[model samples]
Target: MDTATLQHRFQTLLEQHRKIVFKVANTYCRHGEDRRDVSQEICAQLWKAFPDYDEQRAFSTWMYRIALNVAISFVRSNIQRERHAIELDESIDIAIDDSTRVHETDENVRALQAFIEQQDPLHRALLLLYLEERSYRNIAEILGISETNVATKINRLKQRIREHIA
Candidate 1:
């Protein structure tokens, strides 16, 4: 394919699945600045890897794989930086609090988000995709796991959520 054609195709796919990108960024980042940074990084990585994408495969699945990887890396780097900051400022009490927090749609959504936030990164991704109504095959493909494994893990996650909710 020509350069223009490939670029157009990528752009179309991105427009169609842009929510996947935002969802990933929001799921991983607690701060607005961090979310914007993560979203930009995911878009950059997606553009970089678009040329090599296999057209036969599902576009959202491929996009999810890339977005998830970038988001997970961002989380890892953030964790490292936070650890370093804590070590460096063990005695400091810097309180530059902001009162500009955005409200969620409702209490139930906020509660669910809080619960998911407490999960490990992988499990968090799994739950996010599952709640988004991804099929077992698509979730497996996005997560690079077997369909059976996806089903099993989702079952366990559902049980855990039920227990917590109860």
Candidate 2:
């Protein structure tokens, strides 16, 4: 595809799957600045990989693969470099309507975020993608695991979170 067509396709895909970017960012980085940086990095990676996109596969699946890979790799490298300490207390303010009804929801999300932050980068990516309502097949594909393994791991992760919060 030409540069213009590629850019246009990427723009549309980004528009549609932007939330995936944010969720991946939030999972990997606790601070707003870091989240924004990670999101930008993921977008850059996606743009770079756009030219190689195979039309036969689902676009969301392909996008998820690239975004998750970028986020996971970034987190791993940051950990290895020991660049900065991760603070779980940092709030990721996701815009939500019905402010009055958000207290409990926010609390739950914050608790889950904290728990996920404590996990290794791969597990954090898995749980975050699961929370985003991605299918087991997609999760397996993104993580390069079997669908059954994704289901099993998510079940265990859910139990662990429930126990932690309880």
Candidate 3:
């Protein structure tokens, strides 16, 4: 397809799955300015990678992989991220999306948020997908890990969360 046609289709896909980008940015960044920067970078990377997107596969899954990678790299590359990093405090309940779990108590929610906030980028991505209630297969696919590895890591993360919340 032509450039305009590709851009149009890409924009439509982005609009439909834009929440994936926002959730990633909000989860990865602490401030509005950083979130906006990460979100813009994610959009640009997504557009640059769009031509290689496989139509036979799911767009949201593809988008998540790209967004998470971009967010991870953004955090890793930004010296300012270190300056803004807050220790796991009571107010650390950063909601990932509107679908944030309501069943968990506020204390548990804060603990969970704090736990997720402290993870390394790969673990953060893994937990992000896991918490989104994605299937193990999808998590593995997005993170490029084996299904067995996803289950193992999640089990380990569960234990770590127990340790963290203790």
Candidate 4:
């Protein structure tokens, strides 16, 4: 395909699946600015990898893989990023997008978010994909784990969340 055509296709597909980026970013980053930075990085990586994306697979799945990988790497690469979370003088606009977020004021949601925040990065990524309702096979493909491992980890994570929220 021509460069122009590829660019248009990439733009359209990225726009359609944009929420995957935000969901991953919000799941991984504690701060709004960090989310924004991670979101941009995810987009950049997606674009860089776009040319190689197999058209046979679902774009959302491909986008999720790229976005999650970028977000995990961003968090893992920066230790000091935690201490430097710039306190927003205003509300976090990025965190409150029209995604599947539960109400911020709900105690249960807050507890769940706290639980999510405390998990290590890999578990956080796994929970993010699981919460997206991706099938075990898809989760395995994205995270490069076996389907059985995905199921086992998810069941264990589910139990942990139950204990956490109980």
In model 1, how large is the Cα lDDT of residue 105? Answer: 41
**Ranked by TM-score, top first:** 3, 4, 2, 1
Off-target runs (Cα >4 Å) in candidate 1 are 81-107
Off by over 4 Å in 2: 80-84, 90-92, 95-107
Model 1 whole-model lDDT (C-alpha atoms): 0.80
- Candidate 2, residues 91-151, lDDT tens digits: the string is 3345433242233246676677668778987788788778668789988988889999988
lDDT (C-alpha) at residue 158 in model 4: 89
Give the per-residue lDDT of model 1 (tens digit) for 28-66: 776667879989999999999998999899889999999
Error of 2 at 120 (Å): 0.9
Q: By summed lDDT, which 10 consecutive residues of candidate 4 come out lowest?
A: 85-94
Question: Per-residue alpha-carbon lDDT of model 3 for 29-135, expressed as tens digits?
Answer: 87778889999999999999999999999998899999999998988888465655845544444565676634334777778877988888888888988888999
lDDT value for candidate 3? Answer: 0.86
Off by over 4 Å in 4: 84-101
lDDT, each prediction? 0.80, 0.77, 0.86, 0.80
Query: Residue 76's C-alpha lDDT in candidate 3?
Result: 83
In candidate 3, stretches whose alpha carbon ends up further than 4 angstroms from where it belongs are: 79-81, 88-93, 99-105
lDDT tens string, model 4, 115-134?
A: 77778777888888887688
Candidate 3: which pairs clash?
A: none
